[model samples]
Target: MASTPGILTHWPWEPLGNFKYVLVAPFAVHSLYLFAVGAEDWNLTYLLTFPFMLWRMIHNQLWISYSRYRTAKGNNLIVDRSIDFEQVDRERNWDDQILLMGILFYAVHWGVDVVAKIPFWRADGLLLTFLIHIGPVEFLYYWFHRALHHHYLYSRYHSHHHSSIVTEPITSVIHPFGEHIVYFILFAIPMVITALITRTGSIVSVSIYVTYIDLMNNMGHCNFEVIPKWAFTVFPPLKYLMYTPSFHSLHHTQFRTNYSLFMPFYDYIYGTMDKSTDTLYETSLKKPEDVPEAVHLTHLTTPESVYQLRLGFAGLASKPLTSKWYLWLMWPVTLWSMISAWIYGRTFIIERNTFKKIKAQSWVVPRYRIHYRLQWQREAINKLIEEAILEAEEKGIKVMSLGLLNQGEHFNRNGEIYLERHPKLKMKVIDGSSLAVAVVLNSIPVGTSQVLFRGCLSKVAYSVVSALCHKGIQVTSIKKAEYEKLKKSLTTQDSSNLALSEKGYNQKVWLVGEDLTEIEQSKASKGTIMIPFSQFPPKKTRKDCFYLNTPSLVAPKSFGNLHACENWLPRRVISAWRVAGIVHALEGWNVHECGDRVFDVDKIWEASLQHGFRPSGLIPA
Candidate 1:
């Protein structure tokens, strides 16, 4: 909203919320009904409104996805400012304009067709729209847009749009209802004049005109200067006819200039254009991709997880990955991504973040967790991991962490195979098992004497058991094989604290992993707590018992530009494994934490605290 919003600032159907789409139904149904019954020569121009409206919605969403992907990559970015949840919340209403547009299009089509029949195509009519748009629509919007910048209007209207100093493609359409009402009126001039006066308007021309407006609006606000310099150099006059992303960016940075709607002709003619527009455009185009100090190598968890990536829908990425029924509608694209991962396979950058002095990035392995679990897929998966390591080696990333199943014992032997393959590598490869063990051990409730350890043992499980035993805590396991495995790994002093017991129901605290069974959890007495030491979280079936998140901690406030959650973790919380990579880079550690080697648990825990990572949901018993 504006600093001081005025009348009609909210959409006319604002009170209706999402149900506002119900208003468009009657017009749409009426048009379809007449066409189906052949009740008089139908105005196909009006009838085509439904699909074109749908097309416009999709067009806007595509721009949103592209803009997010480009900005996350950090190349060709016109604005380097951070965008948080506040900006997301504020601009979420960009779709309201599309809703308003649907209502108007349906109403106008129905009204005009009632007076006289309309054609389906007219090339001349489309040309007229283009000409009128340049002559009157552009000229009028230039003045009207400038007028909105005046004190009275800016406070009550334009300020709402200008709130986003860093713009996304959708940011161009965010405005008070009063502002959109005027914008629609101006945009409708070309359509209305060509149809009513010239009598040459057709369904195709009207749709194309509106599409041109949407394209220009989304392009100018995409926050990247993608228009190549070579094109402008070839045809100098094109600069006056078309405005680039950086040109409009200057208007937001320096208010009261560059007020042209889409074309720079008026801004150039009236001298409202910013002097730095060309310089800003050139600089933004030349900006290179940043090289980070550390990288966390992660991967897609499920088939549906493609949309959960930072490059996917912003609304979904800001929260934890979850199944949405609507996602089923995207089966074609989802299938394509799965196939493309095999064909065009490579580790790709997901997002970038800064922690104090160290710059970090999160790179994805392009495969899902299900792929890692299959024995047949092991060789292929390892090759991808190896390629990613060599790529990071090429980039001089100080430390790279293997997250989730990327470091699975069965897949790559906790990322040990890479070190054996390339023993002389400079960059440190961390499985993060040490810090993960620390997170699980410290996460146990205080004063707990004995706890049941469940599930299959991994590198983390072995380390966690030793650390617990060293603290004189009783470690009991239900599976004899898992218990014996831990016993052999433990030292004589630590082994004394390890026990094989079937009395798991007696233990109140349950440290669990992959082989954790529902039957075992059910046997445990009510209120038994389970803390995951494994990368994968155990299924939660018992309601009475408390379940802690996988080994992770909340980051310090200094972790800036971080808005999206890490996988299933909550906002601002990070898994211990991923956090270990950043700590390694910050401390400039040269040692590798892969294979069977263990870092000092106490030392790793202390270093984690010193660097400002707090425990998540770890409460005293």
Candidate 2:
């Protein structure tokens, strides 16, 4: 699903409008029943129970409708998240559900003739009903709910409820009829047991208890926080007693914790409370605008790696060993993913915002499995990237960085094609390698004597080495021919007192090459740093070694227990930082000549037939 909509201050009516009249339908029926039969006769109290069932349905529907409406407007009480509108559209059968519920509820109530009057003022029946309902119902439901999560039961029945990962109120009741039957028995058990044991027949007491349970159930699935942070702060002990919207949301999302019915006390007692529950709850309450914007970045991911992540996710959904048949069944899904990856693929926004309220939204450019196949489909992929850029621009994103390989090479080669196609779009597109080089330079410590610049043959690498050498820092390279060319350029240009060499001058090693297996093998200790141009991680890497990885289409494999790259940096974040760097780099350029970034300006002009126009000082040879 896309990101949740901007929070609306006013009450939302779209989702609520679906149930506005439905909620009152039961009340109309209740009114008719009361009008037909006067309160003078207590003998027919059994029939009046159907009206009680109707009232319960109405109240639950109201909570569901209101919660959904609020969440859709982004006025969610807790988490800033949303489900696909498609899920809501597909599950728009609540009218049918309510009719079925009404029939089932009437049958259950009619079959049981246990008559009980209102016990609003009566202490004995009210207290007894509360005790019985809370104790036995909670105990029984907890085990029953946990059992429903078992693989066998879950595949057959419970997965229906789990279908709504981001749930609404009706989602609580969207279960199999068999599970519903089990719940009905559980519900009736407490009331019937309480009535017989106390020798009391107060229908009002049972109604109140049922209403309270229904309210909590709907609230749990509401997907909006109804409890304020201050309540938990002031009380301090209320979290143990009450289940917040976030508390129940974890059950739907993480699928393990917060399994109690009305109270979380049972979850706590059973040691099943999610470890991050409190923190996640409070974090979800923060305003979306308060988070920092993330600059999303991405490169090509191997199909094998992508498939592995898919399999891991599938395993999480089903048991692994016995579910090999399930895996075989998923070949069609995997094939479809391959086909989709060749077309639209998955483009997503990071669900959570940063601390500074910056959300990093991402766009994935589609490609094939192998490199040659990707090359053959380059034009198609470029079209997808262009489409992604246009879409991001429409969504108010000012700039988006291209990935390093396919799209990156395309932009570096035929940037004019993009400019010619989308002439009116204001969104800036850049390859981002220039900014990445600048960031690496700034990160290197001040007093380093000699630095190895691997992969110096490429224009980006050559540009970086030139800049560093011009700054009077010694730079070395492995590629002899490129190193000799750079040495000639520095000597002829009369750059600042430079210590440029062909090889063997390494005091600190900076591995800038796409292939790092050679450097990884040669480096002994202290000075090895990895600035990968591809998605591969450093081999036998140390924890202290510096590694800079741009967010890519495929995540890099983690080395041992350490993460070698800045894996969390988003593509938009890279764009934001790159824009900032361009503003800094523009200082040496002719101010009156252009306002756009050098590479961005290059797209509009065809200065050189072979290498294209190079902005002066920004990409000096």
Candidate 3:
């Protein structure tokens, strides 16, 4: 069985059009019945009930209409409201019609029972008949419902109801009328038989049963998880034995297990209940082609196999102890403990290695290793910068300013130092206190266009460019590497005679990069503008610097002087684990064990990849 469409796809609001008509038809019939019987007293109550029913109908209709209007206008009441209504309508089945008819029929039954006053005749023993009626009726309904799913019956009639996998409220009433009538007859037979046998009938019991059935049936088909957990908990055990969203949801998906709608005991006793709820009602019968070979490998190596092997040896060793059944049971217990210990140790080793690498870097401890790529973050920042630059450029501005200053102990009086005293790429030094760099760049704005800074300096740059944008000053990135690259790319014809002169360093183009403590000073001095970048939490601290000198236990026998190598072995192992498929399987198993029912295998894979696991040679091709 496959998973059904999401709940919202079959929301009740869609098929509300038929509700009013169904509801009115019942009341219309009731009104005629009351008039023919000359029941003037029941007339007022019937009139009141009509409006009550009408109110419910109108409420459903108005909600549906408003939702439709909102959807048509491309305004979603909730997130992810991108629905193809036409496609849904095209695929709609008759289940909804059956649901509506069922409700109407139940309502009419209740009305007839109320008008007949059957309870008045059996006032002394009414409760006994009610209980007897309920038991047999529930039993018959459960069996008949189960029978509908038999291979022969399902292909003929039942499949039509399940065709609309995601049931809409109106579609809840749209089942084939013939199926509905058959079901009604089957359901009513038990009650009628029990009533005859008991010799105690009650109109009140009939009315209550009919109303309860309609409400619950409607709820089951409503395609919404609106019922509270407490409601399910507090309801009688037999209530869950009948149809609920969870039960019905399973039925819709598998159409085999969970056949008993009014009682789960029947299904449980009949061995139809699926013990493993990992996939709920989803079909467990995997196609031969869909069964991955990896699953077979996993099963072969699972802890259960190891435990069985250990248990077999323990059982032989405990021959005398086996005479005492309780002592023999300890053999399996000891084996289970050994298996559990191995699993725990393996998990601990993996977690320890993962934490070690994360602790080695100043970078954030990413939720997943794939995030290290920083694709989305980089794209977003680039887009913002591009838009800002383009807007400024459109206004005839050529020069942009950036406000930045070197901080941290590695920096000298001149803002230049390798971040960690690296042997290559000596950092360029700049005067931290003086505004000379800003002034020089500001003067040659037209020729040396573009300024770039890390997000940490965005705010300061924003201040410097604010006045320039108004007066048409364009600014973009001016990093040395970028500048050199652009210079090489510029053609002689396109190149202007631009000189980086110190006089061009004017206050107008100088944008402060750090947080502005002196906002009043910045505004008062109209020449120099300052903007503050949004502050982010500091990066994680690296306790010790990693180099190639790290030794590896798995080094080749021919290798010499392993300690001389600069590569970090632990970091590589951590990275490998992050990308491993086994790690994801473990995570999935853990989530399921923890009782989080929903599982997304792809999400697990993506998270594993983001965390730093590269496949390398370890992953099977």
Q: Measured by TM-score, how close is model 1 to the native structure?
A: 0.92
| Pick by lDDT: 1 or 2, better one | 1
Query: 39-81 in candidate 3: lDDT tens per residue?
Result: 7645443443444444444344333333332222221111111
TM-score on alpha carbons, each prediction: 0.92, 0.44, 0.33
Q: List the residue pairs that clash in candidate 1.
A: none
Q: How many residue pairs clash in each candidate?
A: 0, 28, 58
Largest TM-score belongs to which candidate? Answer: 1
* lDDT order of candidates, top first: 1, 2, 3
lDDT against the true structure, each candidate: 0.85, 0.51, 0.34
- Superior by lDDT: candidate 1 or candidate 3: 1
Write one digit per residue (lDDT tens) for candidate 2, span 499-543: 445445345546466555544435524545555433233343445
Range of the 10 consecutive residues with the lowest summed lDDT in candidate 3: 291-300
Off by over 4 Å in 3: 1-134, 168-172, 189-203, 222-243, 278-621
Worst 10 residues of 1 by lDDT: 109-118
Question: Alpha-carbon error at 9 in model 1, in Å?
Answer: 3.6
